[model samples]
Target: MNSSLQLAVPATRNRAPVGPPFRRQARSRLLRADLLTVIAWASVSFAVALWLADGGAAGFSTPAGSFTALGIVAGLIGMDLVLLMLLLVARTPLIDGAVGHDRALEFHRKLGKPSLYLLLAHGALVAIGYGIAEGLDPVGELVALWLLVPDMWLAIVSIGLFIAVVVTSVVTVRRRLPYEFWYVVHLLTYAAVLTAIPHQFSVGGLFAEGTWQRWYWLAICIATGAALAHYRVLEPLVATARHQLRVSRVVPEAPGVVSIELTGRHLDELAGSGGRFFIWRFLAPGMWWHPHPFSLSTEPVLFDSSGRGRLRITVRNLGHGSAQLTRLKPGTSVAIEGPYGLFSTAARSRDRVVMIGAGIGITPIRALLEGTPFEPGNATVLLRGHSEAELYLGDEVLELCRRRGATLFHLTGPRSAGEHSWLPEPAVHSGHRLASYAPDIADADVYICGPDAWARSVISAARAAGAREEQLHYERFDW
Candidate 1:
């Protein structure tokens, strides 16, 4: 209802040069990613090196000794991997800024299975090695250890918890379970890590007190825990209290989509770039515990002289957690964590820009188009949907394109029947591709958001049309 609430762009007609600054930022991010990769591998190497320094290699001279040595190595690497996974999901700004939150989480998911395998191997091999030395079978040795060792039972419980967490996380099983159910089970990961710690310090001779290995392991574990607490727990509380956000209004955008607006203090400071998202927790009964990551549908609007402003996020009823958002009433307090991801103007590498969105994914594109800097006629907007009704906020996107002198296309129709293409059925049949919509796409920065499969198709098309990986910015909608 209020057109003025849309983002305001500078009235300048001159185009800002995009070469040097864009390259510098892109190079910086690449370096950070490279550094993180190095650090992760370095940690694993250091763990092995610590054992070698303590004469671990000499243990490999015999069959039983070799098994024990291998088990020690497996445990060390597995624990290191567990620490890395924690840091990845700790919401640390360094990781988030370097690779984006979604990519970081993807890496975390990948490490889960490998880490679990190593841990399981560690337990089995250790039991076999001990059994051979004591003239008993592995199962008998395991039972004896459980009965005789001080912390073996806790270690066994830790492994069981790890198995449950990893099993529920598999894609097939995860789809069948409720998000909350999976989330609660995932929280048991902390308990698993804690339970496994006692044996490492108290039973393992490698990390005995006063040794450098002990100090090194202790430092890494403590740092990981501290980071999790500060970023995942303490930081959200601080941000919520600092912003003092409250629901101002809720406006329906489409059949199942709604825009929830909020007013808060020092909004400009918290105002993330267009296309960036924040994890919002509405302090309402039965819903306060679920955090929803939604992007701004419009830029934050600074309303008065005292730094108070309003921001809005458009969401659809895609899941149980998000379905409850439609019932949100005015004045409900909000807790937030982020402004994360790289699908914004900050990732631009060229003056020319192309934005493509499908269904509710069009919301963030609208926000990005509002405030991102580009010359008149240098930007292109493409909205794809099965029908016109699915193009939520179509009118506003068209208005913004017209005012900014950018080309706009609304591609509405059923998807291609037999092939995996992002274009509509007619366009695909006619051999019209991304290049047909934006002829200079190779020289443009392409931003895409949509369902996972559809977005992947779009990305493939862009790459085939000669767009560089650094020039393609994609935000996943189904996180």
Candidate 2:
């Protein structure tokens, strides 16, 4: 194995199962859409089958005829179930910001909805079909359906639990609840999914009717089980195994702005780019419970030029953890884990790049364009700030652009009187002028980092200008 491929920690606490490469398209956003289509088609097919069988068709009487329809229904429902499981596992890691996690979870919930619908239909079809043949009551019908295989009640409960999970996962309810609480509740999905074992073993006669079925279940269980263990258990163990860093300097850029720097051995070993960040400095060492995330505003370089990289974190006081960080001083030991996320420019496929930086979110974009082998001639930097005073590193940015032969477009709010030198062209919201200011809009890969709202705007404009989804990248950082 490659040395770099070595696992940093002994294990992960909770990791989702890996999905197929195709599922990575838009990170599984299409799963829900595709599942819905399958459900719709399957429902129509089942309806037609029921109508034909009720029309006194002799085909319904044959074991082969009934088995074929059941097989079709089971196959459609099973495909959806498999996709949902894949989606739940391969999502991006959650760092300081919740956007990535939220998006993935939303997609996961959507994909499961259609599966739940199919499962309901699966039960109803079985009960109704068997009931009609036997002339049984509703209670007896249900019992008879399970009578085919008594242990299938586990499947019934699994379906019920799946419904419950989907209900709670909805945005309306999920938002009103605490994230950690919701997270724990979400983790229970494994138990609900695992409980389907007995039913699938007994009644999923298509796959589990023979010895091969047992192996199939075993394989699925082991894969999903490993994912759960990695994310929930192994990741935490790995983080805990690492040593912490001591906070060396907290330089105040302004009252609300600050740059916190830290020093530690092996800090240089942390792989990151401009758009990524690490969960940082929580309560104490070994308490890998809740570490905050921050972007590196400057280039990733050896902090002191001695090979041990120093981390320079630029932070804008936003919430509880951020506000408290201002009080921390030199010598305060901190723990940071995760150089996770693929939001950087490196994640893209194109060479021509367009970047928009709002507030301190400029850190990662700046780091990438400056530290990496990126040339300015192929990129455009659109820096937005509240005012000239709020804008940091204007001179440094200009120098970097000059070195790379890149164009720098500075957009700032209106001033009271005199003209400003930093405001290169008059700030205009007009679409034409905005496009003209950044000529790279036509073909360059667009990267937006900073406030979510601003990033959203840049993405809208980029997409509107015909930029492909593959060329769009965003790093959401709190100001």
Number of backbone collisions per candidate: 0, 18
Native-vs-model 1 lDDT?
A: 0.87
- For model 1, residues 312-431, the per-residue Cα lDDT tens digits are 999999877888999999999999988888888777778789999999899999999998887777888899888888889999998988788778888877778543467888777677
**Which whole-number lDDT from 0 to 100 does residue 134 have in model 1?**
94
Give the per-residue lDDT digits (tens) of candidate 2, residues 50-80. 4344442543575444633553365345533
Alpha carbon lDDT at 320, candidate 2: 57
Clashes counted in candidate 2 amount to 18
Model 1 misplacement above 4 A:
1-20, 418-420
Error of 2 at 219 (Å): 1.8
Model 1 poorest 10 in a row by lDDT: 1-10
